[model samples]
Target: MTTNIDIIKSSGEKVKFSLKKLSASLRKSGADEQTINEIIEKVKEELYNGISTKEIYNRAFALLKKKGGYLASKYKLKKAIYELGPTGYPFERFISAILKYSGYDTQVGEIMQGECVRHEIDVVAEKNGETTLIECKFHTEQGRNCNVKIPLYIASRFKDVKAHWDSKQHETKLEAGWVVTNTRFTKDAIQYGNCIGLYLLSWDYPKDNGLRNRIDRLGLYPITVSTLLTNREKQFLLSRDVVLCRDLIDDLFFLDHLGISETRKSKIQNEIAMLCKH
Candidate 1:
């Protein structure tokens, strides 16, 4: 069998199937080495030229469910986030909730003045006098990277904000400028952010504090992860400002308001509770 096979990505581009990358993703989802190898073999056997990554992901997820349900659920996280929006607002709000859970008071879509210009920050996190200005880049499609230009543009904005506040008398103690995205960052983006002391958060970037790690740590799965909610249902919830799994836990009535059947509502609540359990 040929090792090279073209697979269509979510960005409508075709790329070579990567066994090592698949293994890495499974390992990150807490799969044991044996399971990872088994899944890889299964996926390799199923691969063909022009197969989509979505197809590969579904196959892997289904196999994971058979091997271990919890791992399968965990594996759904990145895709769940992608389901958060065609627009990034829902993602920003979701990130705000995560920060709030982590002890940072957060605000989404705050307008602030910089030294040189006015900037609309996505999420502002404040904890114990330390403030972090966050920019969220959300993509509904896979294989779309947060490229170097993003960090460059954001860094410039941060400098403006930092310089402005440093000259103000209101005692704003700014800690960092952060860029968080649901997708991966390009190599150049990571390198540029690190060189300038900018905080770059993306899916599986930093070993301990990547966006995925943070979500896992907080048990903050998005509402899109629930199998009870169909894609249209999830989109409806998103339209109504219901984004997080934790949101469902807090207000089961929200589900009821959406006209979800009582039986289905109970099932969804149980699923959300398990997935978002701290």
Candidate 2:
């Protein structure tokens, strides 16, 4: 492999490619070292100056998918999150599912009265007497990021809603506001979120505790991560408010409703079980 060949990131930044990073990601997918080496070699053969990281990923993913089952599903985590949307609604529901599994009683798209106006919070999570208002900034494009103005605007809305919330309370206190995005946040966004005591969770933020980390740690992968499902099947599950793999496991009736064959049903169930076991 030519070390001098540069690659373009989704952010449009160009940098020399790192075989180490690529290898590490594949290893995280539980791919055997030999398969990873083979994929790396094939990917390297396709590389050229200014190749988008997205293309590199697609090549690697296609190779992995040929191995079939949960391997491809696990490797496609980032892309799977993107498939959760064409709209932010499914992403919000996905986030809500994550928070719910994390032991927070969660609601999606709940309206609350602010000091001056009403706000439809993307997610309202309450746990251990602390209530947090969350807004999900979902983007279908991998190259897009949540910029500083996002948090700037969200923080202002938080203040208004918190003002109203603080005036009266039952059990939970309006403790903090959070902004979560599927993609990365700009450095300024991260800094501002910290400055205002607002929590920001993105793909890889908060040190080792970003949104991706949370999902990996808790095994609450979105239904979009299923390698065994078609786009139509995935969209159908999302429409039924079945976002998490865990949700699908519990609501097996949806499988019957979709007329999934018993053989395919068992395989899907097994793949999900293996994924959660990660």
TM agreement with the true structure for every prediction? 0.86, 0.96
Could you give me the TM-score of model 2 versus the true structure?
0.96
lDDT of each: 0.85, 0.90
Q: Write the per-residue lDDT of candidate 2 for residues 86-185, one digit (tens) a residue.
A: 9999999988988888899998999999999999999999999899999999999878998999999999999999898889856878988999999999
Q: Which one wins on TM-score? A: 2
Query: Which residue runs of candidate 1 sit more than 4 Å off their true CA positions?
Result: 1-44, 63-71
Model 1 lDDT tens row, 58-94 = 9999998887345776788888898887789999988
Top lDDT prediction, candidate number: 2
Q: Which regions of candidate 2 deviate over 4 angstroms?
A: none
Q: lDDT for model 1, on a 0 to 1 scale?
A: 0.85
